[model samples]
Target chain A: MTLRELWFRLTYPLRQRRIARDLREEMSLHVELRAQELLSRGDVPDATDASLAARRQFGNATRIEGAARDAWGWHWLDGFRQDLRYVLRQLAHAPLFAVITMATIAVGIAVNAAAFTFYDAIVLKPLSVRDPGSVVRVVQDARITAPDVLPFSAYDALRKQARTLASVVVTTPPQAFATILPGRSPDEPSIAAARFVSADFAPALGVGAAIGRWFGPDEDAAAVIDYGFWTRSLNADPTVIGRRMIVGGRSLTIVGVAPEQFAECTSRKPSYPRNVPHSHPP
Target chain B: MSQQTLAAVEREPIPPGTLDMLILKTLARTGSEQLHGFEIAETIRERSRSVLQVEEGSLYPALQRMLVKGWIAGEWGHTPERRRARYYRITAAGKRQLERELESYKRVSAAVALIIQSA
Candidate 1:
């Protein structure tokens, strides 16, 4: 192929409209010439009839015009553009179907994304503390050749004897305690999800308080609240520190609110209105 | 539309791919003068004694293809009545193509002739 032809084909999209007009005009002139030839030969009665006869013999001019343009090249891309336009028009005609289809695809992607985000944060992600790799959980199991379910009686024994390790702390799971809110009637006390932990629980985990402060070592009747309970039941009261709440029939003062992320360490099930009273384990 | 008109002319459609050669031959015969699209179709018909009829559908597209192939060049010119028309002139490539097509056609026809005569 010559460079001239190659250049023409490469620039087809830019010049297609002008080329189409030129082709139609050229074919129309062909029709006019055919009409004159018919008149010279007396094939038709008058000029108008001769012209119409010529047009009839030429077949569809618009179709011929399209075929002539197709010879220039890139007809497949043109056909695809037309098909896309047709699909868009149909989609616009049925707005509900378009919305439903879009929503279905969006929800499918969102579900996978959300599940992965949670799995990464909870199971795969490390705990947010200094030297998280060094921190370990100690529990007795048959596989470890130790007695299962360490009782609260071992709390003092583990601290005194486990001096070989860097640090040792003990904590009891949430215990049942009837709780009274500041605004509510004291008689209608609901169960408060409370935990009793050793003095080194916060220092061992290296997590600090989000508001107020952690409890003092050997402190009595001082309560620490996680951020969720502070907002949900206590209405995120700024004066929550030093405010007293009746738990287990004893008044415990709120000392601090736990940071939001630290809530994962205290409870796995995410209970509400949590109170961690600094008392002996269990 | 009518059997009468069909019987009078007995117009036969040009064989596929032969129209380009015929067009090249028509332009070559015109020598220095360029022939527009209608004249080329008419010349082919008249030369074939009205046996061939070139449809605008085939004629214009073939012209366009030949134009892009560098086998023919078209330019807008005025008719005797001062009306605008596109005139086509055969190029060197068109003459070469015409010779190649004629050689191929002759060889194929001769082989067919040999087979038919044998049968």
Candidate 2:
């Protein structure tokens, strides 16, 4: 390309027309400079004649524009800002409608916030897993298709086949009705909840035992209860880790206690002693 | 009386044609070197001192718009005066647009002037 064409192509992507105007002005200056140089050397009447001659060598402006647009993609942000400003103006005009819409949005936001807070506290937050983004729950194919919980054999198979997962832990939660020693009435039974989980349960979520070590692998007779469990049921004993308690017709040694914030899964499932016969054969 | 119409006039939208041209020329003169939002606005103001005046609020929106269009690039960095600022640089494509626009605008304006004078 010639010098003028080359300059046009170089500045094509610059969206500001003023920049183009400045460039054109700069080019015109250069043309005048060259023309004056020719005139001083006794070439012609003035720079205008020299510029006309220069223009003959310089290609058509239309071709240069086409090439510039083809080379540099369209700039659309200016139009978008224009549209946004227009919308903001329109929204500002109708105060009553805007207030009503905002009120509806505010109500919706509050409800969502409350529900999420409850979910994060009770269901989602307690898992002490390493990089929760990498963790996946092992649900049965049948459960995914329908809404039923996984059976014992399916859970076992899922654990065996999904080797890509970091770890697999299961929980069978149960609700218990127990009598507390010190109450307003002094002989009232309190409602409590508990879930039975594998030894790797706490380790899967990266949560450590608040007191002693959690039940070691292959130690089914031991149980790691929550801090609330010891405080409310066992009277907050300092040395409760070695103590045994009868829960759901089975005696379980309190091997360790979890922090108050940590909790195991509480969803309905088989093998939950009070709920159903879902335990696998030992 | 609702002040909405008055507010709209007070904060009129920057015409797309003008904004695009301003960004292109700003980048072309400054080169694709990194420039903060304030510096870019200042540069445009100084360059068009005789013709036009650009406000900071309008400049920022135009800069943002340019970034979204990918015509120019920007990044957060410390200014020479030691303030946190967003610096912008012109792309190769922006330079080409400046030249094309200058040619088209001059031609169109000249033609319009000729028509007006003849009539």
Candidate 3:
């Protein structure tokens, strides 16, 4: 027999209580029969001596008892852990192939887990979103625009149609550029990005700002920078909420800082051109 | 009894021809009782005296082949003391085969002996 098969056979009795009980009974019967045969042959021995010899031939009695106890406590976990260690040692002996195989398997497992997590969160998990089934993306016909830069007029038409979309909202992400404003840094120009969005955009996504007030649904020429920007750029000024700022060469009042999670898109949803449907129409 | 038992323990050489045939005859004469493997080897060695000595290794393989060919059947049981053991018994086909082989050997031996006497 192979070493693995022998190991399995030797351990099976100890691993299972029912099998161990049966084996103990069978072994006792065998020893009893032999002892009786010896007695008939005129060999006189005490009952205790016969029992001791029978147990000794098998191995130490206490070892078997300990094995049975440990089986209940760990329940094959110890054996599986040992097997894993042995497998690792064997893999290490073949270093080059082991490395390649491990790398390949790790990449495959990571990608599969990430995709499943996203699918579970976005598609399977119930959302408090409005018209969730009807919510869809209406984008550029040519299928090529920045993900944070959907056109306002296209969104307006989709919202008006009523037959196509329940509602349409446009999101304009922050555009970063070199800022020359005095006292912005150590008397030197530095990079800053700003965003502009329609008021309904925050409510459409069903999230709200944490501090101060959010913009009204029909309010135009308004914006909300990220909380990180508000703290670092405006020096945490409480009165900064109603201040005007230049974004994309257009004037917009800072209504409030956006909430933490609303900072950026964690996933890269591909940008589509101006005339093509990027996603199903909402 | 001691001499016979001691002699039984020793190996004896056999005549060159018809080794397997002799084994078949021995099993046939014994009424095919359930016998331990070592006992079978010892019996054949003692009864044949200097004429035959079947190696224990040869017996096992031959018995296995016989089992496959349907000449004998093997079964696991106890010895008289109930120790785990295997026993072999000849089948009807094996008895028939023994009869044919014995006759062929008798004819050949007789013919060879007559030619040697004349020469």
List, for all models, the DockQ compared with the true complex: 0.48, 0.02, 0.03
TM-score of chain B of each: 0.89, 0.70, 0.77
Give the alpha carbon lDDT tens digit for every residue of B18-109 in model 2.
76687677777766476665455446655654234454334544554454445677665664545455567876666766678788877987
TM-score of chain A for the candidates in order shown: 0.61, 0.46, 0.51
DockQ of 1: 0.48
| CA lDDT for candidate 1 | 0.80
Model 2 compared with the native: what TM-score?
0.36
The Cα local distance difference test for each model comes to: 0.80, 0.56, 0.56
CA lDDT, candidate 1, residue A127: 76
- Model 1 Cα lDDT, one tens digit per residue, B1-119: 23354577787899887999899999999988999999899899899988898988899999999999989999999989888889999999989998998899889889999999999
Model 2 segments more than 4 A misplaced: A1-113, A119-126, A141-148, A160-162, A175-190, A228-237, A264-282, B1-119
Residue pairs whose backbone atoms clash in candidate 1 = none
Decreasing lDDT order of the candidates: 1, 2, 3
lDDT of 3 by residue, B1-119 (tens): 22353464554555555655766776776774855445565577668664456643345445544544456665767767666655667778778777888899999999999999999
Provide the DockQ value for model 2: 0.02
Interface RMSD per candidate (angstroms): 2.2, 20.4, 14.0
Kindly list the per-residue Cα lDDT of model 2 for residues A180-212, writing each as its tens digit: 322224345455555666657666767676787
Choose 1 or 2, whichever is better by TM-score: 1
Error of 3 at A257 (Å): 1.9
RMSD of each candidate relative to the true structure: 7.4, 17.9, 13.8
lDDT of 3 at B101: 82
Q: How many clashes (backbone N, Cα, C below 3 Å) per candidate?
A: 0, 29, 17
